[model samples]
Target chain A: MKDPMIDIRNLSVTFNRGRKPVKAVNGVSLSVNSGEVVALLGESGSGKSVTMRSLLRLHPKGTSIEGSMRVAGNDVTELSARELADYRGATVSMVFQEPRLALDPVYTLGQQIEEAIMRHENVSRREAALRALGLFEKVRIPSPERRLMNYPHEMSGGMLQRSMIAMAIACNPKVLLADEPTTALDATVQIQILLLIRELQKEYGLSVIFVTHDIGVAAEVADRIAVMYAGRIVEEGKVADVIQNPKHPYTRGLLGARVELAHGRDRLITIPGAPPDLAALPPGCAFAPRCAEAAAQCITDVPRLTAIDDTASVACVRYA
Target chain B: MINLVGEPSPILPVGERGGPAQPLISVRGLLKHFPVKGSGFLKPKKVVHAVDGVDFDILKGETLGVVGESGCGKSTTARLLMQLITPDRGEILFDGESAGETLPLSEYRRQVQMVFQDSYASLNPRLTIEESIAFAPRVHGVPAAKAIARAHDLLHRVGLEPVRFAGRYPHELSGGQRQRVNIARALALEPRLVILDEAVSALDKSVEAQVLNLLLDLKRDFGLTYLFISHDLNVVRFMCERVMVMYLGKVAEIGERDAIFEKTRHPYSSALLASMPKMNPGERTLEPPLSGDPPNPIDPPAGCRFHTRCSFAEDVCRQTLPPLSRISGAQSAACLMAMTNSGHSRAPVQMEA
Candidate 1:
């Protein structure tokens, strides 16, 4: 394959809190080909969101990142503060979980998108506004001309989200990192947003790293799926392969736990146990405590990602 | 002008013989519209149709699931049933009797209780689980010792370790454990009907299952009736014997769990079912989502409120409001097409194909 659009190798993120340190992302390596959508799938506190956020260096000031993290062929760790500023919203853009909060409350939707374009691209205010309007139309925000004048609160949640997407794509970035962009949206609106994202990804040849806790969403949109658990990716494969024939116990549990509306009247299955505290992670595999198939070795040595098949990798002793 | 009521009355009906077979709560045409006044001095008044024209019956010892998106008025309906808000129109009957007026609802209050969505802030941080659970009973004049004993029994019923959790404050418990305490507290008054408003929505998947299972078990053991309101379709399908789909503050569809899931007649209901994210990648076909949010509730569409988003809408759909009509033996929907299909052939065949 032509050099992957984004490559992350052995990426680790640690947050220091007084004497205690939280390893939020542990040795995660991911790659996304041009125009492909990769999903970071896991439940809350599973470190999926943190792993993707670390790609942008969006974590708090206390965070310390290690390993080779490159996006669009640029070494992210080597970028100076000034370069990092230009990199964000220019080379790689993000769509946050809550669009209402992500947007400036005082500014109109059009103004925000225009601001994003002008900040990254040296353009006149008129040109930026025109570009913002064009982006809004591309994202299917109806009556883009009128909506441009509406404040974040004036527009509905779905419209605001589309506006956010419009801003993200205004720079024509190579990589789009969406962190649970549709989590706060209703189901019907979520469908529209996902479709829009997929369309934009193909149209712009953009590599998308979509993060979400909902496995169903990942199944729908992801070309490749990475199942994270307790700061590490336990399984990675094509969405079809990983969802249908998942190798890791955590992935299986997650799939089984979803209540398929199509499964009319079947008893719902669910996993047991809350996620482990990041500050006090277990010594062995992070999911070992919750894994139904965990063996003696699982509680001692942490499992590394091993090839389960040509298309899949599983970090589990059973698969190994 | 509306009459200022003495107090908000419980929706539970009165005078019906308490029995295992009779439904615990029945609501009809429940409406609660808040007047929206503009910020300016000369602002015109508008009504926010928060909960408009809702009706459902919760059977004794059965869970009735209410599913809808945000702003669909599911929570508002729950609050109305609990008599936390006075309805602008309609009647609520508990058991066999109308819970007459606001003041008279005091007698009906003990029979109904509610569990809110946020378990974190629902319980008093300063009060221990024992005290939280005992608050209701003690206020109703139950002896202190008796209420404490009852609270302990309720704690055990909700699967909480009485000794460990009894004296612990709300902040001391985990999310799941704290929710269990909330459930125990709601049951402290020995209510026959419990309204759970998004009770498990905020919980993680695993913890949600534990609480849901606990709810099912409690329903069986205590012979309780539940009006379970939630936005998660998965949770609703699992917990409810019958499901009610709401849209724009109206009942879109209602039927047995299997019936609604298998044969949803309403366009809005079908869109909602289609919009849900599927775990099976093979099932991820390009189904279109509903185009936009429901028309502003303040000025809902004239005919079918859903006509604005309905892909198969007809001319009549925009001009004439469809009434709740029978779709099949057990299913009911407010759709003109379903009602026009009087012949069995049209109804069944159209649904199948």
Candidate 2:
């Protein structure tokens, strides 16, 4: 399929900071082809962010990671410290949830963009500054020159996020990892940012992995949607198919919970319990406790992600 | 003076309460401005026009939604109603009596309670969930035992089993569970008006629905009024009977939920409605409904605050601020286009369009 831009196979991430070793991401397999936008959809503690962070190796020391991740031809897990540093922004870039906290307070937005450009390419300070201005223009930020000169706090939430996107794309990375980039902004500002990101992704032919908890956001941005449960991808398919016809019990419950203003919300179909703890996950399906149609097998054995068609899969016994 | 451009009617939809329902709270000319630091001596003193010239009435037993962007003064309005911050110029009337004079601020505050967005920061780490919920009632001289009983009853009503959860610390519960505790605490005072300022915004969609349903139930069971403030439009649409759309400290629109959502009059309200993410993938939004961030609230535009980003702006819009004028049965908009004879070329046609 023309070499997937970002490919991950049976990836698992474990955090050792606490007393117990928490397996945050357990055997997640995802791939995004060139110019494709795949959304990692999940609620809090679903390990969607943990899976995405593994792509950039953003986890801390003593965190154990297994399985293989390939992004723009560099083996992410096997990269040496020096190679990893060189490979980070130029090969793949990330946009975080809170741009205000993600950015350095003291440095002006211009300095940050310029630094990113200079780090990746052999460019002079003036060229980098010009490039930063170009990026601002590309992102449709008004008064680009003045805005670049403003510090992080000086800019509003939407403007700060636009600048963050500018920095993320300054290196012209093939893969873009946006981790709930619009979650903190207002709805109007969020749509503006989403359109900007989509436009930029198209112009650059960037393979993007967008992570968010909001289903509507996933529908708007993603070509393919992967529904994550406790540390595992329970369902994956074409965005429309997954959203319109969720197969797994967890996926169905999530879709059923989607209450729009247009629909008459009599009652939201809630998944009766919370996400399982990463440190103390039960045997079998992690979603078993909350799944309405959970069979006895769901509590006895973990279901594998079984493919239904070319682009559809569900990790449930019913689907199998 | 911020008077109505046209003769004011009951712009809001009639409350569910029949026969000339008394408003629980009436906030008139509410204004709160914070001074920007480091603007002394050399430069002109600049203040953020946070809650400038805001006016709205929360009718008894109804959920009046306050919706706007981050700096749009929805939160500020909530704080003003809760009496958490004093306004520079305004009068808050509780049941036709001026608070701090006839009604008394303490009594007014006792009838009103607030639940903030951050569930963790709002709760006391040292106290158990039951303690947190009972604190408000005990302070109001409800007696310790009665307050604790009330707390347990509220916890049960909010779907948290008191037997298992009452003794647990804030850290021991999930985010959804913690928020339930916050709700229980807000209700402990037996307040008439509860200001839920983004109370469910941080929650996951499934859990948010649960909380929303719970709020509706509590409102019905306790006969409480809610100032449901949120940036999320879908939740607001489902939860609120009437809505007030604010922009840069001004009421952009206020109306019945159906009228505002279906027959939107104000351009800003239309944009806000259009900004909600579509459920169907086939109908995903192609372009942003509104461009640019909500203009800097500090030193706001002289006339219309939203004129800079508004697509239908004209010189007249820049020259004079349009006050809220009733364009429909249940909707009022502060846009010249919606105000007939407001001097805008499209005002006459804009009313019917």
User: What is the C-alpha DockQ of each candidate?
Assistant: 0.48, 0.68
Residue-level lDDT tens digits of model 1 in A1-320: 58888889999899887788988888998888888999998877778888888778888897899999878888999999999999998999999999988999998888888888888889999999899888888988778899999999888888888888888989989999999999888888898889889888888988899998777789888999999988899999999998888888888877766655325533456676778888888888888888777788988998999987777899988878
Would you list the clashing residue pairs of candidate 2?
none
What's the lDDT for candidate 1? 0.83
Residue A59 in model 2: lDDT: 95
Candidate 2 chain A: worst-modelled 10 consecutive residues by lDDT: A261-270
Clashing residue pairs, candidate 1?
B12-B94, B13-B93, B13-B94, B14-B97
Per-prediction fnat = 0.58, 0.76
What is the TM-score of each candidate's chain B when compared with the real chain B? Answer: 0.89, 0.92
* lDDT, residue A114, candidate 1: 83
**Judged by DockQ, which candidate is best?**
2
Residue by residue across B268-336, what tens digits does model 1's lDDT show?
888888888877777774756688765677777788888888877877788877777767767889877
Residue by residue across B1-353, what tens digits does model 2's lDDT show? 77668676554422222324778788899999999999866999999999998788888878998898889998888888777888999999887888888877777788888999999999999999999999988888899999999999999999999999999999999999999999999888777889999999999887887888788888888888899999888888888889999999999999999999899888999999999888788999998999888888887997888888899999999989999877777888999988777888888843555
Instruction: State every prediction's TM-score relative to the real structure.
Output: 0.92, 0.95
Off by over 4 Å in 2: B1-20, B349-353
Q: How much lDDT does each candidate structure score?
A: 0.83, 0.89
